[model samples]
Structure formats: structure tokens, C-alpha cells
Target: MSSIKVECVVKAHNEIGEGPVWEEKDATLLYVDIYGPSISRWNSLTKETERMSTETYVGCVVPRSSGGYVIGEGTRFAAVDWEKRSITTITHVDTEKSNTRFNDGKVDPAGRFFAGTMAVEVRPTELERKQGSLYALQPDHSVVKHLDQVDLSNGLDWSPDHHIFYYIDSLKYMVEAFDYDLQTGGISNRRMVYRLKEDEGIPDGMCIDAEGKLWVACYNGGRVICIDPQTGTRLQTVQLPVAKITSCCFGGKNYSDLYITSATKGMDEEALAKQPEAGSIFKVTGLGVKGIPSYSFSG
Candidate 1:
């Protein structure tokens, strides 16, 4: 375990703050409060945060190559112009599963948006039900269903070389790797690369570093850990001030800062009282590492 200083960058107290995307051109951080179903932007230079309420649960937001954002909202994907607060539909998926919504997603090296879904209301009885799936939205607006039977489809990213795709199905407590086809945006040869212990917390959202290590936010564990995916060995751990750490991404002047998002969605009043920082966005510096720039959606 490495002792690192964590600072709360935003204290908005989001019910479920999940996605954290850094826009370099604007020097701002973009994230979504899934429960609020709003997209927010925090300016690094001004220290001001602005939010735009959406009509659906906005799970993730990625900059679009054409200007604006490609957002995953509920079962539909839309293009959002933050400046004008306008949205246009791209497509709707898996309409049969009305209870599921997009959870976490990212733009691939080839500029395609890949995201997954989870049951909107996770209940004890639904624990064993495989009610989720993963999909990829191509540059031409076509959607592809890659995986089914996912209980909670949370994080997705690619290896530095773009040959391996790493993903998290939180309900399985495993981090999986697939042989990636960058040119075709296809994934195969799926295998488990890392599995969490019962005490390590449920794996939620994840991102890859410049050196190829995977940083995973642990829900209910109050920590973010660096794991070597090939060997399944833990490299470093960042203890957080609050539990329910939902997601993380690297963003800063040099891309060395690790931005973390957390949640207070299911916490009781007493739990929230103890961890007021829950649902706040946190940043960790001095790790002496950098992350690759996140890609933007081509369409």
C-alpha cells in the first residue's frame, strides 16, 4: 500500500457519480451523475463546475470528433451539444430489457464508443440474473452486441498496443481480457486476467495506464488498486476517504493525475453521515506515472 494524498475536486454529493472523462482542449473534466442523470463539467483553470440535466440516465460522455459529445443515456445513444444543451438520438439498443441502462464506457483507439449495461434497479433477487449486455457503437452509427449474460457490465478499455481489450463484469468479481481487433473493432479470446478477493471489494470501473497496468475502483472497498493484468498481482493501492468508489480516469496537465468518482446511491443515512465525501470526485497526484489520452468518438 502506498500512502498518497487524495483531494476532493468536486463536492457535489452526487447520488451516483460514475464516469470521469478529461477534455484536454478545454482543460476540463467531464463526468456524469447517473442518478441525477446529468452531465457535468469541472473547469480546471476556473475551479467552476457546471451541470446539464439530461432526459435519461447519462452513464458516460465522450468527446465527439465532430464537436460535442457522444453520450450513453439509458438504452439509447445520443449526441449532446453541451453549449446549446441539445441532444439528437443516435440509436436505441436492447429494448427488450427495459430495466437496464448504460453503466460505464469508453472510446476505443479506432474512435468507436463501447459501453455496457446493468439492471436499473439491482435487487437481491436479481443477483443471479444475467440481465445485461455489452455493445459497441461504430463510427457509422451501427451498434454491435459483443457479449450477453452480463449481470453488471461496468468498465471497458484497451491495452496500450490495442491488441488486448480489458473489461470488468463487476458481478463476477473478475477482470477479463480479450484478443482485440482494432481495425474491425472486434473482441475474441476472452479470458480472466484478474479476480478480486472477497475483502478487496467489488471491481467497478477501470482504466489502463501508460505502462499497461490496470487501475480499478473498488466499490464498498474504499480504495483504488493498481494491478498487473498479466500476472494478476497487485502493484499499488490508493486508500480513499470514502467507500463506494465507482470509477476513475487519468487527467491533468501531464495526464499524471488520477481522477476518481464515487457513489452514495445505496448508502443509508448513517453511512452517508460517516462518509460525507461519498459521491465526491477525488484526485490523486505524485504517483509518478502518466496515462494515455482518452480517445474521442469519431461519429
Candidate 2:
């Protein structure tokens, strides 16, 4: 364990701040508050934050090559005009079920937008099982279902070589890897790459680094662990000020900074008072590592 400093860059105080993607073109960080039902952009240079309120839960937000942004919100994958704050739903799935919503996702190297869903109501031991699925919106704007019966489709990413797709279901308390087909946006040969102990908390959002290691945010564990996916070995541990750390991405110059997101959801007044920075956006430095830029949706 090496010494690293975690700074509270933004006192966001979101009920559930999740997705975080770096925008290199604008030098800003784009993230979503699932329960705040908002997408926000934090300018690293100016130390300012801009938020866009949405009508429903917004799971993830990413830059689009066509302009504006792409978000997996509610039950639809929509296109947003940030300047105008206009949202045009490109397509939707799982419409038959009203209790499921999109959770976490990212763009593949080939430009496909991938997202998954989970139940709307989740408690410690009470949950609606198998109500969600994973989906991909192709550059051509076509929808495809990759997996079903996903109770909690959370963090997802790919290997530096783009050959392996890593995913987390949260409830499984493990990370799964798949053989990725960039040309077709398909995944196969699923196998477990990493698993967490009961004390480690649920795995939430994740992103890969330049060295091909996986940085996984532990939702209830209060830390992020860097794992060598090849061997399921834990390499580094990043303790956070808040216990409900939701997601993270590497940003800043040379991609050396790890931008993390947390949530204030499910906490009582006593819990909130104990951890005032529960939902703040965090920046971690001195890890001596760098991450690759997030891919954008070409559609």
C-alpha cells in the first residue's frame, strides 16, 4: 500500500452520483447522479460545476462524436444537446417492465454505446430479482441485447488491447470478463476475473488503466482496489472519506488523476453527519499510474 491523497474536488452532494467520464477536448469531467437524475460537467481548470436535470434516473453520460452527449437514462438511450438541454431518445428496451432502469455503461473502442439496467427498488436484503438486461446502441442506431437476467448490471470496461470486456453485477460481488468482438460489438466466453470478499462491499463502477489493471469502486466498502485481472490479485487499495463510493475514472493531465464519485443515498441523518463528504466528487493523485482516454460514441 502506497501513500496517496484523495481530495474532495467538488461537494456535489448528489443522492447517487455514479458515472464519470473524462472529456479531454474540454478539460472537464462528465458524470451522472442516478438518483439526482442529473448529468453534470465539472471543469477541472475553473473548479466549477454545471448540472442538467433530467426527468428520470440517469445512469451514465459520455461524449458523442456527433456532438453533445449520449446518456443511458431511464429505460431509453437518449441523445442530448448540452447547450440547448434537449434530449432525443434514440431507442429503448425492456419497456414491458416499469421497474427497471439503466445503470452503468461506456463506449467501446469501435464506438458502440453499451449500457445495462437494474431494478428500480433495491434494499439491503430486499430486491426485485432478474429484472434487468444489458444493451448496446450501435453507431447505426440499432439496439442489441447482450445479456438478460441481470439483477444489477453495474460497472463495465474493456482491456487496453480491446480484446476482453470486464463487467460487474454488484450482487455477484465479482468481476466477469468476456472475449470481445470489436467488429460486431459482441461478447462471449464469459469467465470470472475477480471476486470480492463479503467484507469488501459491492463492486460498483470501474475503469481500466494504461497498465491494463482494473480500478474497481467498492460501493459499501469505502475504497477502490486496483486488481490485476489476469490473476485476480489485488495490487492497490485506495481508502476514501466516504463509504458509498460509486464510480471513478482517470482524468487530468497525462491521465494520472483518478476522478471518483460517491453517493449520499440510503444514509440516515446520523450517517450523513458522520460523513459529510459522502456524495462529493474526489480526485486522487500520487498513484504513479495513468489511464487511457474514454471512447466516445460515433453515433
Candidate 3:
């Protein structure tokens, strides 16, 4: 395996830049600033950026086959018009309970939106923490609770063959795998694929490369690791200067450039003083891996 080296590409100070997806058609990188309540697009070729704001916290954003984007925002799913800068709410989740909000999410191969919620308060009691649930938005705009009792639902991705699903609950510090029935949208046979020691930071957002390897952002660990899912073996580690690596995705024309997003949200003054590039976007060249294409909102 080759060594991973990250270099700063876009230095926009994002408060909580999370989910990142590459739009191949537009040759741009699309990501969300959760607390900023906005979705931003950056052109890899021109280095120009455009943003669309939302009324509530934006959790994730993905390209839609019919054009525009599907965005997960504070317990609701919406369609965003890039040209018009408009947002239309398609469905709402946990509307009555303001204490639970959307966290990390992604679109499945079938074009359905999959997003999860987290407790609003940082220190919720055991019961409140269990309120976080993973939701699936059907093509008809109907929603279903796929999984419950989740705490800090974060990383999500699918294997290259599309036969397995991987997810993470940050507090648990484990990356789990499920037998994914893609045609029917069923997940079974859950198993732990990766677990980090207490010294290593919790896993955050993740992506699967074409070789079926998982690349996970190690929050507070200041690194990204490539691991073999079946064997649970660490292939390589890419070090970063910042301690809070929020998420990463493969982009670039050839799908070889690895783009990473870090955060400065939870860092204290002392930590920020030491790592100034905490919230910057980084690009690592020569990754020698290709990522799966972003799923479009066929629904």
C-alpha cells in the first residue's frame, strides 16, 4: 500500500462541513455545512464556488438524475434547485420533536434517500439518546424508520459490488456491515467490520473505493485510513494536520483525487492555536483508487 498525504485545496473555513459527493456531470464537489445550514458547490477546474442556504441545518447533499439535488436538512428531506436557489420540502421527520435533528445521510443505488437523526443536546440521557433513528425516504416521499436507538449516526457507504452496507455510530466507535438486499432495500446479518481503540479517534464519514476498500475519516485522530472490509485489515493511513476530519469522497475527472473535509467546531482555543487548518478542505493526490459514482435521485 502507498502512503497517504493530504494537501490543502480549498481553505474555506466551514463550521461543520460533513457529507461530500462528487458531481461528475458538472465536474464539481458538493458538500454541506451542517451548522451553517447551507449546501456548497466547488468547481475543481475553475476553483469557483456557489452556495445555497437552507432554513435549518443541512446534513447532506447529493446529485439528482432529474437535475438539481436532494438534501437532508434537520429532520426533513428537500429538493434543491441550484439555478434558482430554491428549496422544496418533500417530507418531514420528527416534526413534533425539535430535540432530534438529521445527521449524516446518503442516497442509495435505487435513488431513495437514507438519512439518520441525532439528539439535539450534547448530553442527552440514555432515553433521549435512543431517540436517534435511521430513516429511509421512499420514492413517493413516504418515510420509514429503518433503525432505532442510534447515537450519532454518521458514516455511510456501500461496497463496490453493492452487496454490503457499511455504517457508523460515532459514540459506539464501531463500523458495522450488513448484508444489503439492494433490489428490495433490505439489510440483514449485521456484523462489526471495524473497531478503533480508545486512543484512536471515533470514525466519522466514510467512502468505498472501486477496489472495495473502505476509507474512513478518523475524527480527532488526524488521519484517514484505508482498510479491507472482509479482513478488517488496515491497508494504509493518510495523516492530516487537523484533528477533526469530518468526511471524505473521491472526485476529480478520473475519480482518483481524494477530497477531505475537516472541522473546527468542537476544538477549544488551545487546540485551534496548534492546528490552524482545522476546517479546511483538502485534496490528496495519487490515491491510486477510484470511488464509486455518486448515486442519483432517480425517484
Cα lDDT listed for each candidate: 0.90, 0.92, 0.84
If both were scored by TM-score, which would come out higher, candidate 1 or candidate 2? 2
Q: Show the lowest summed lDDT stretch of 10 residues, model 3.
A: 121-130
Candidate 1's displacement at residue 192, Å, is 0.7
* Deviation of model 1 at 184, angstroms: 0.6
Instruction: Give the Å error, residue 255, model 2.
Output: 0.4
Best by lDDT: 2
Residue lDDT tens for model 3, 34-95:
87878899888899888888898888887877889888888888898889999998888877
**Residue 46 CA error for candidate 1 (Å)?**
0.8
Clashing pairs in 3: none
In model 1, which regions exceed 4 Å deviation? 1-3, 123-128
Q: What is the TM-score of each candidate against the true structure?
A: 0.97, 0.98, 0.95
Residues 199-258, candidate 1, lDDT per residue (tens digit)? 779999999999999999998889999999989998999999999899999999889999
Clashes of 1: 0
Name the candidate, 1 or 2, with the larger lDDT value: 2
